[model samples]
Target: MPKHLNNQSSSVSLTVAAMGVVYGDIGTSPLYALRECFHESHGLPVTPDNVLGILSMIVWSLVLVVTVKYLLFVMKADNEGEGGMLALLALSQQSRPVDLRKGLNVVVTLGLIGVAFLYSDGIITPAISVLSAVEGLTLTTDVFTPYILPLTVALVALLFMIQRRGSGTIGSIFGPIMLLWFVTMALLGLHSLIQTPEVLRAANPLYAIQFLIRHAGVGILVLGSVFLVLTGA
Candidate 1:
């Protein structure tokens, strides 16, 4: 009976729990995604259009993927809301025999693949998060240089040390903080939009075509980076 789903099915509870498990994956990324977008991928003298184009794409993708695709479409695709391939396998079996149309085998295989990738992603995400956060310590002192390993160790140690307590208390009281995060992100994007709305001409699929035609390699990289953002929770 987690707060999100009161009196829901055990299957629904399982699905919501899976969603909660991945919150860390999304939280870990906000630290670097945008910086990587404009600085590393788009490159500087980042024109307003470039920023707007990217921002528009990011926003709409969030709407499409998070709002429409996952929360709505994929969730509807859930097997009793437990989700993933394993759940789908169960539904397929209930509907027909395993050998009937190979549905059981196909769904089960895909389900296992999803779980495998997610397991790897779960481990890699936390490591990358701690690594990136600890790197911030380097900015304050050269003395911390020789101790990067130790600093990382200490930071990671502290993060794990708090795990048993859960962050529910902090999350409950810090609703405003979360709001500020979204507000600030929106404001920065609005600022960019105000500067060069025309860059939004890139919103046209033609721009994508031209971008691909002109700078195929960089375009592919930017697209790949954008794909990562779309994959965010």
Candidate 2:
């Protein structure tokens, strides 16, 4: 291939890979995050105000934590060309003051703990994402309801089996699928927005503030739930 075409192809591949691997968790989060906010345990009433408030919280969390914090700040912390908890830990050890060298154990421990959390999330996230999607079949027909667990298990197992093929292969396979899923969701959301344009009012920060003030204790719980928006992003 020509040089410019090669560069374009590489860029496109990276973009697709990011959409598949990075966005997948965050994409599936909407499946259960909003529902969790209004679960019976939360005692959250599904009034229009409450709905708008929750939406506002989710929107802001994504903007601040994912967009601003991760994209702008965290992305800058890469060690050389590498990233992730281990890479940062290595970078920190190299850059630390001589006086702080004695505390290396503590730093290493903290980094290891962060790695453990990532591992746990890796295990839990895939299972939950697949199961939640499979369970949606229940809403369409009762026939699939009974087999939901089995189907989820089989699908998840297939995912793990494919893992041996490596990230590049997985990305090439999953990228277009996730891309289509996101595009479909965007269209659906746009259709809904066209019908209820007032929902856009949730974009204001005041609704989130008002929600916290009115709900008080419950608002804190909902805030934790809203943090789910940052899962994959």
Candidate 3:
């Protein structure tokens, strides 16, 4: 494959440093997503079809949003090296008429607010992931509970310490690690599928639509919780 456009020396350094800081949360997420998905909020083994449907939605969302929409299309719309909602808004404002410009600015400001919230979430995600993982020790034994904070602090400190070296040292390993991670996840999902093949039925959009329409009351109450599933990226 050709090198990324942002592959210059300084750019590469910055990317690695940024990845070192950003990837930990996502890298650790599979530790919980499948587990929680299978363990439904109700005391029933979640229908396998629903699990697969959700996974399918997640897979396609990544393909559409990350690969096609952002990488191929929106990234090409970059102004200089910047690309974000604000950048697009700025570009659009240049050509929009006065009447439309006022409406667009209101929309742009709201988009910017959401972008800022997501950015803040990204910055804090690592600490939250590490903290939650380390806190798991408490599940095994409350006697060890006192050590959780210290352990979390130590792990976070080490994570930050590696940022100085940048991600280059570990960069080579990431692709294989990600491959293994996905393969392992697929295996577990397949096992779940074997246990519950009926889940394959939810692949139809009708199931999701029907479920949402039928359970509007519960869905309304849990909309925020449902959205957390999409929060990792």
Candidate 4:
């Protein structure tokens, strides 16, 4: 193969591998996000209108925050080809004049806090993801309920055990698995969508606005749940 062809293949492989590692948290969140919207803690009824409203909120949030804000705008603000809060802070500090050093201390402090939050997410995300996956056993059969915690613990242990092999090896394995996972999710979503074509209307922002208007008191709670969709974004 030509050198350019080899380079192109390498780039594609890396992109798929990156998707495997990066998409896992956000990919699995849908398992609980919609259901949590109607959880008893939220005090929201599971009416059709409420469901549509919640769906609308989720769709619009992904579009606005993930697609527009992060992909389009934030991705362009990378510092030395890196992104995230620390990179943004570095870029900001670099752009500012050295004479304006008074507030730089505050900026550095906030950047450290952001890094702390990132570390917390790294710890919390996998625990929640594993728990959510194992919890699905309960839906299949109550007989599995008692084993859920133990099973989740075992799976998490195995996950960490494999981490010693490093990210490239993990990503190579996870990449194809994630591709299959996404395909399955797409098919399942399509089946449900066929049954309730009306849900497609929830893609419109008007439904979300109306939902908030109709249930102003509980709208805050619903928004909290909807925010879950952006957990790993």
| Candidate 2 local lDDT, 1-233, one digit each (tens) | 99999999999989998888778789879987888799898998899999999999999999998889888998999999899998998898796633554655777889989999889878877887888789888887899988999999999999999989998888888888899999999999999999999999999999999999999998999998887666776
Give the per-residue lDDT of model 1 (tens digit) for 102-121. Answer: 44466666767887877776
TM-score of each: 0.62, 0.89, 0.60, 0.88
lDDT to native, each model: 0.60, 0.88, 0.59, 0.86
Q: RMSD in angstroms, all models?
A: 6.7, 2.5, 6.3, 2.6
Clashes of each: 2, 0, 2, 0
Candidate 1 wrong stretches, greater than 4 Å? 1-28, 37-57, 96-104, 133-153, 165-177, 187-206
For candidate 1, what is the TM-score?
Answer: 0.62
TM-score of 3: 0.60
What is the lDDT for 232 in model 1? 42
In the range 93-193, model 4's lDDT, one tens digit per residue, is 78653344455576777888988988987887778778888898888689998899999899999999987889898888788888889899999999999
Task: Pick the winner on TM-score between candidates 2 and 4.
Answer: 2
Model 2: number of backbone collisions: 0
- Worst lDDT run of 10 residues, candidate 3, spans 219-228
Error of 1 at 169 (Å): 5.6
